[model samples]
Target: MQSLQDALYNWLTIKVVCDVRPDDKAAVETRDFFEEILTAQHSVSNIETTKDDLMYYISYQQGEEIKKRRYPRELIEIMINQINQEPEKYKDYPID
Candidate 1:
């Protein structure tokens, strides 16, 4: 139970479906943006999206008071791309 809870808290292992159209012809641009762990047991509270990019909200346990940071969209995209390309680099990210 402890490991399961840790897995759930650390990683997002859910299959989310959306009603949208996919363009196969559209080429994906995989930029070597991030080269580190973005989901290394960090506490991610909420993620908000905007017209241009995304808003990544993550909190941290600092002694007593919880600290947080709102990362920009570019960073978020880089992190996602890194996570997707994990254990297999130089591959195009899946269009999900």
Candidate 2:
């Protein structure tokens, strides 16, 4: 049987990789923005960046589950707009 601590650890640790197209400066900016949000939430265990993708190893406490998905370019643009327009709204919430 697994100990409670082990189970919790497994639940908290999640790895996700995000891929973006064009590999341009804008894509880099998007990755940076997401990284800042992740760092502020204390959920990033590791981050690996490349020309076209970002690999994130995240860990959060119980009750906080990070969803793993690919973010389309349009969504990234929307996130950039939101962050620029209402940075305060995201100050308390973890990155989605």
- Residue pairs clashing in model 2 are none
lDDT assessment of candidate 1: 0.32
Alpha-carbon runs more than 4 Å astray in model 1: 1-53, 82-96
Worst 10 residues of 2 by lDDT: 9-18
Clashing pairs in 1: none
Please give the RMSD to the true structure for each candidate, in Å. Answer: 11.2, 13.0
Per-residue CA lDDT of model 1 for 7-67, tens digit only, reads 3222221100011112211122111011012223233233222223455454544345455
Model 1 — TM-score against the truth?
Answer: 0.30
Backbone clashes per model, in order?
A: 0, 0
Name model 2 segments beyond 4 Å from true. 1-23, 48-96
